[model samples]
Target: MSTIKRDKGLDNTLKVMKEGYLYTTNQRNRLGADNIFETRGLGGKRVLVLSGKKAAETFYDNDKIERKGTLPKRVVNTLFGKGAIHTTTGKKHIDRKALFMSLMTEGNLKHLRELTRNHWYMNTHRMEQMDQINIYRESIILLTKVGTKWAGVQAPEEKIEEIATDMDIMIDSFRGLGTAFKGYRSSVKARRRVEDWLEDQIIQTRKGKIFPPEGTALYEFAHWEDYLGNPMDSRLCAIDLMNTFRPLIAINRFVSFGLLAMHEFPVSREKINNEDDYAYMFSQEVRRFYPFVPFLPAKAKTDFHFDGHKVDKDTMLLLDIYGTMHREDVFENPNEFRPERFLDWDGSPFDLIPQGGGDYYTNHRCAGEWMTVIIMEETMKYFAGRITYDVPEQDLRVDLNSIPGYVKSGFVIENVKENLDRR
Candidate 1:
C-alpha cells in the first residue's frame, strides 16, 4: 500500500481560505502525490485531499462517497441552504435531483437560450447609450432578469432586483472570514431574505393564489412529493427552487471570465465570430481554464480502499476541482489559454470539470452545467459578433487567491456600439 503524504500543520483552514483555488494543488505538488494526500482542515479535522481524473472518479463514486453531513454549517446556512438537494444521499438525492433535471430538457434549455439572447439585446441597447460599463456588474443585473423570468418566477421589478442582489451577495460572501466576517454575515441575511420570499411563493402556489406554469421550476418544486410521497416542506421546496435561480444567475461569473479570455486572446475573439463551432470551444475552455468551484466536499460512505490506501467510514474528503483541470497530464501546456485544445479533446467528464466531474443524471454533477455552457456560448456570440466595444486600460488580472475569482477591473469596456446588421 502506498502511504498518503500529509501536510505538516495542526490546522490548515486558514491556509485554505487564504490560498483559495491553489490550496490543494499546492499541497499535492509539495507532497509529490498525483491523486491523494492528507491535510487538516478546520480545527484540525483530518481531511483527505484528492485530485486528478482517477481521484475524481473515486470521490464521486456513490458506493464509496456520499454528500450528506459533509458540508459545514456555514456553507449550508448561506450558500446551499438547509435541506438543499446538494446535501442529500442515496435515493433521496436521486428523487430531489430529478426535480432539477426536469427543468433542463431540450425545449426548456432552448427557451433559456432565447431568454438570454433577448436580455443581451436589451443590455446592448442600454450599453450603447452609456460611456463605459463593467461587464461583471452589468451581467449580474442582466442574468438576474433572465433567470427569474425563465423559471416562471413572477415578481415586481423592484422585488426581482432585491432578490437578485441578495443572491449575488450569497455567492460572493461564502468564502470570507476574519477581517472579511462582515461579508459572511451579510450572506446569512441575504439568504434569509431570499428564502423568506421563496417560501411565501411556495405557500401561495399551493393555495392557488398564484399560478406558475406546469413545466416551470417554481411550480414543480412547490408540488413535488418526497421519496416517501409526502408534500415537500415549503422551506425545502423554496431551497429547491433557489437551486434553479441561483446557479443561473451564477453564470454571470463565467460570462465575465469569458470576456476576460476574449480580451487576453484576441484570436479566440476572432474565432468566436467567424468559426461556427468556436463559440462552444471557447465556452468549454472558459469553464476549464478559470477558477469557479474551488473544491467539492464529501465523506466516505463506508470503509474502503482507494488507490491502495485505506479510507475509513465517515472520513472527510475534499476533491480538488481547479487542480485537476490544469494538470499537465490532463492537458498539454496546461497553464496556457488556448481554446484550440478542446477541439481535439475527448469528452471525458473528469478532465474538464469546472462544473464537476461525473455523469449528470447519476452523479452529484451540476444539473445546470449544460445550461451554463449554452448561455456562455450565446453570450460569447453576442459580445464577439453582435456588438463592438473598446477595452479600456484597467486591471484584467483575476486574483487566484480569492474564492470564485473575477477579473479585477470587472472587464471594463468603453465606446460600445450595436452592430444591427450582424444582429
Candidate 2:
C-alpha cells in the first residue's frame, strides 16, 4: 500500500485524515494485508480508505504498478502477467483498451446482441411458473451462452460447467466454508470430466475457420500485437482470449453483487443518478460490494515501504478488495449502500470499479470493463423497470442493510413488465 494524501472532492475527507494517522502511526495494531478492512475502518493512526480513489491510485502506481498476481492461483497463472491484458498501464494501456473496443464495434455488438437474444430463447425461462425467478441463477447460463455465441467460440455448453468446476477446485485449495471443503474435492474430480469435453471443442476450433478475418473476437485477439510483435503471441493470447467468454458469462455474479447493493442501500440510488460516469460509478460499486476474488496475493518485486513499514521482496501482500470498499475514511456511511456519493448532481456514472482503477487494457485495470458496464446497465434497467420481487424478512432490514440477503432469500419474480417477458 502506498502512503495516501487526502485529495479534493470526497465526502469523508476528515475521516480519512484521522484513519491515516492511526494506520501510519502505531496507535492501532498492524493490519496484516490479508485481513478484511471495512470500507472506512480506522485503526492505529492510519485510516485504510478502501475507496479512496487518490490513495487507490497511489497504491496501484506504487512499485511495479500493474502486478497481475491478485487472482487465484489457477487464473493468475493461466490468465495474468505479460501475455494477459490487465498487466498494462499508462498510454499503452489506452491503446489496448481501444483495440478491445474496436473489436466490440457496431457490427460486433449487433452480432452479440443477436446471439444474446437467441441464447435467451434457448437457455433461460421461468424455472417454474409459480416459483420465484432467480436472475442470479439464470445469469450463469445466460452469460455463458451469450459469451460463447458472441465470441464465436467453438465449444459445447458443458465446457462452461468445467470452468465453474475448476473455479470450485481452486477455491477449495484454500480453506472454504464448512461443506465447501467437501465440494472442492468433488470439483477436482469434475474437472477431469470437463477435460474430455473441452478437448473436443479445442480440436474443433483449431480445425475450423471459426476465426474469420472480420467481426470475430478470435480474429481480433489472434492477430493482435504488442511487445511480442504484430501477430503478437497468438497461441498464448488466444488461449487467454478463449477464456474471455467465461469471465464475461460469469459476469452475472458481479451483476448480482451490484444489484444486491442497490436493493440493500436504497440511499445509494441517489448517488448513482447524480454522476456523469454512471458506468464508472456502478463499476466501482461492483468492486466495492462484491468479493470477486477472495484474496489478492502478490509477491513483492522488491523491498518497498507500505504506510512507512518496510517489506522485503518476495513478501506476499494480501489486498482484500472487499475490505477496501468498507473503509470509513474513503466513503461516507461506508457500510451503507450509497451510490450518489460517487456522482455529481447530474445522473451520470462516476468513480466505481470491479476491476482495479486507473488506466486499463495495457495493465492494471480490466479490459472488458466498458463492455461489462454496458451489459450491467441494460440488466439493471431491466430489473428496476420490470420486476418487483419479494424482499426477504431477515436479521437485517432491506431498508438499511449493506446487502439484503442471498439470491435465494425472498428472491422472486413479480410485477414483471416487458423486459421480464421471456416469451
Candidate 3:
C-alpha cells in the first residue's frame, strides 16, 4: 500500500466551512490522490476524506468503522438528538434500526404517499389565494402535517407550525459556529419540548388513556423493546419518533430542488406523470444532481488499509456523499439535470447515495430514505400534473457553499392554481 498523502494544515475547518460541499472533492483533486487523503479538521483532529465507489464500500464496512463517537456533540444535540439511532452501534443499532425498518413496508409507504399528496392538495387551496408561495417553507409545513398524521401523532392543528419550525431550526443548526451554537441551545429546548410531548403520549398509550392505531410508527415505536427485550426509554422512543418525522420535513429541500429542476429543465416535467415510475426517476435525478448532506463521518474501529492508504484506529473518516454522486468517473455529465439517467441504470447503493450508501437494514444509512424518495415522487407528480402554478421571476441559484443547499429565493411560484383537468 502506498502512503496516504497528508494535508498540511493546523486545521481545515475554515476551509471546510468556506468550501462547504466541495471540500473533499477539491482537496482530493488538488492533491492528485487516488481516492483517499488525510487532513486536520475541527479541533485539529486527524480526518480522512474519501470518495468513489471503492471508498464508500470501505467506509460502510461495519467491521472497519463505527458511528459512535464520530459525530460532534453539537451535531448530535442539534441535528440528531441525544441517544438517537444515529449514535448506536452493533446489536443495539441493529435492533433500533429494525424498529424503523418495520414501518417502511410497502403498505405503509403507500399510506405515507397518499397522506403527503392529500396534504399538498389541501394546502394548495391556501396557495391559490396568495400571489406567491415559497415551496421550501410551504413544503416543511405541509410535510410536517403529513408526517405527524402518518406517524399517528395526535398533535393539535395549532402545534403543527411550531413543530415544523423546531425541525427546521434543528436542520439549520448543523452549520454556523456562534449561530449554530445558539441554534443548538434552542434545539435542545425544542427537543425537550417535543420529547416531553411524545413521552406523555407513550405513557398514555401504555396506560390505555389513548391508543394510536396499530401499525402506525408512533404506536409501534412506543411499545418497542430494545435488544435486551426491555421496554425502551421514553426519551429514546421520542428521539426515534422525531427522527422519523424530522427527515420527512427535511425532504422539503429535495422538493424545492425538484421544482427548480422542473423550471430549469421544462422538458423533464413532461416525463413525470400519474405513473410513479417516471416520477421516481425524476426524483432520483434530483437527489443526485442537487446537494443534501455533504458527507458522513465515522470513526475507524481499528487500523485499516484501503486503496493504498492506512487509516489509524479512532481516526475520523468522512465519506463524501456529495462528491461520490458527482464523480465524473461514475456519472456522465453529472452536473446536468437528467432524469432519464436512472431509467435504465443499474441500481448500485454506493454510486448514487445522497442519503448514505450500503444496505439500509445493516448500516447507518438513513432509514427514512425510501420514504424520502416516495415523498419526492409524489411531490414531483403533484407539481407536474395535479397542480398548476407559475414560477415567478426569482433568483433560483443554489449556493454550493451552503451545507444543505436551498434555492436563493426558495423556488417562488406565482398564480398558483389547481389543474381542473385532473380529478
Candidate 4:
C-alpha cells in the first residue's frame, strides 16, 4: 500500500482560501503526484484531494462516494438551499433530479435560446445608447430577466435588478467561511429573502391565486411529488424552483469570461461568428480555461482503495474542479487561451467539466449545464457578430484567489454598435 503525500500543516484551511483555485494543484505539483494527495482542512479534518480525468471518475463513483451530509451548513444555507437537489441522495436525489432534467429537453432548451436572443437584442440596443456597459453587471440583470420569465416567475421590470443583486450576493458568498465575512452574511440574508418570496409564489400557485403555464418550472416544481407520491414541502418546492433560475443567473460569470476571451483572442471572434462548430469550441474552451466552480465535496460511502491509497468510510473528498480542467496531461499547454484545442478534443465529460462530470440525472452533475452551453454559445455568437464594441484597456486580470473569480474591471466595453447583419 502506498502512502499519499500530505501537506505540511496542522490545518491548511486558511491556505486553501489563500491559494483558492490553485490550492490542490499546487500540492499536486509540489508532491510530484498526478492526482491523489492528503491535506488537513478546517478543524484539522483529513481530506483526500483528487483531480484529473481518472480522479473525477473515482470521485463521482456513486457506490464509493456519496453527497449525503457532505455539504457544509454554511454552503447549504447560502447557496443550494436546505432541500435543494444538491443536498439529496439515493431515491430522493433521483426523483428530484428527474424533475430538473425534464426541463432540459431540446424543445425547452430552444425556447431558452430564443429568450437569450430576444433579450440580448433588446439589451444590446439599450446598451448602444449608453456611455459604457459592464458585461458582468448587465449580464446579471439581463439573465435574471431571462431566468425569471423562463421559470414562470413574475418579476416586475423594476425588481429585476434587485433579484439579480441578491443572486449575485449569494454566489459571491462562495468565498464564505474564512475571509469573505460580509459576503457570507449578505448571502444568508439574500437567500432567505429570495426563498421566502419563492415560497409565497408557490403558495399562491397552489391556491389558484396565480397560475404559471402548465409546463413552466414554477408549475412543475409546485406540483411535483416525491417517491411516495406526496407533494413536496412548499419551502422545498420553492428551493427547487430557485434552483431552476439561480443557475441561469450564475452564467453571468462565464459571459464576462467569454467577453474577456474575445478581447484577448480577437481572431476567435471571427471564427465564432462564421463557423457553427467554432462557437461551441470557443465556449468549451472558455469553460475550461476560466475558473467557475473551484471544487466539489463528497464523502466516502465506505472504505475504499484509490490510486493505491486507502480511504476510510465517511472521509471527506475534495475534487479539484479548476485544476482538473487545466491538467497538462489532459489539455496540452493548459495555460494558453486556445479554442482550437477543443476542435480535436474527444467528447469526454470528465476532461472538460466546468459544471461537473457524469450523468446529469444520476450523478451530482449540474442539471443546468445544457442551459449554460446554450446561453454561452448564443452569447458568443451574438457578441462575435451581432454587436461591435470597443474593449477599453482596464484591469482584465482574474484574481485566482477568489473562490468564484471574475475579470477585475468587469470586462468594460465602450462605443457599442449593433450589427445590421442579423443572423
* TM, every model: 0.96, 0.63, 0.96, 0.97
Model 1 clashing residue pairs (backbone): none
Off by over 4 Å in 1: 177-180
What's the CA error at residue 289 for candidate 4, in Å? 0.5
lDDT per prediction? 0.86, 0.47, 0.86, 0.89
The digit string of per-residue lDDT tens for model 1 on 247-289 reads 8888888988999888888888788889978999999989988
The sequence of per-residue lDDT tens digits that candidate 4 reaches over residues 43-69 is 788898988898899888889989888
**Which 10 consecutive positions of candidate 4 have the poorest summed lDDT?**
176-185
- Model 4: pairs clashing at backbone N, Cα or C within 3 Å: none
Candidate 3 has an lDDT of: 0.86
Better model by lDDT, 2 or 4? 4
Question: Which one is best on lDDT?
Answer: 4
Once fitted onto the true fold, the runs of candidate 4 whose alpha carbons sit more than 4 angstroms away are 421-423
Model 3 weakest 10-residue run by lDDT: 175-184
**Residue 59 of candidate 4: its Cα lDDT?**
82
State which candidate, 1 or 4, has the greater lDDT: 4
Estimate, for each residue in 206-244, the C-alpha lDDT of model 2 and write its tens digit. Answer: 556444444566556655665436554434455446445
lDDT, candidate 1, equals 0.86
lDDT, candidate 3, at 29: 84
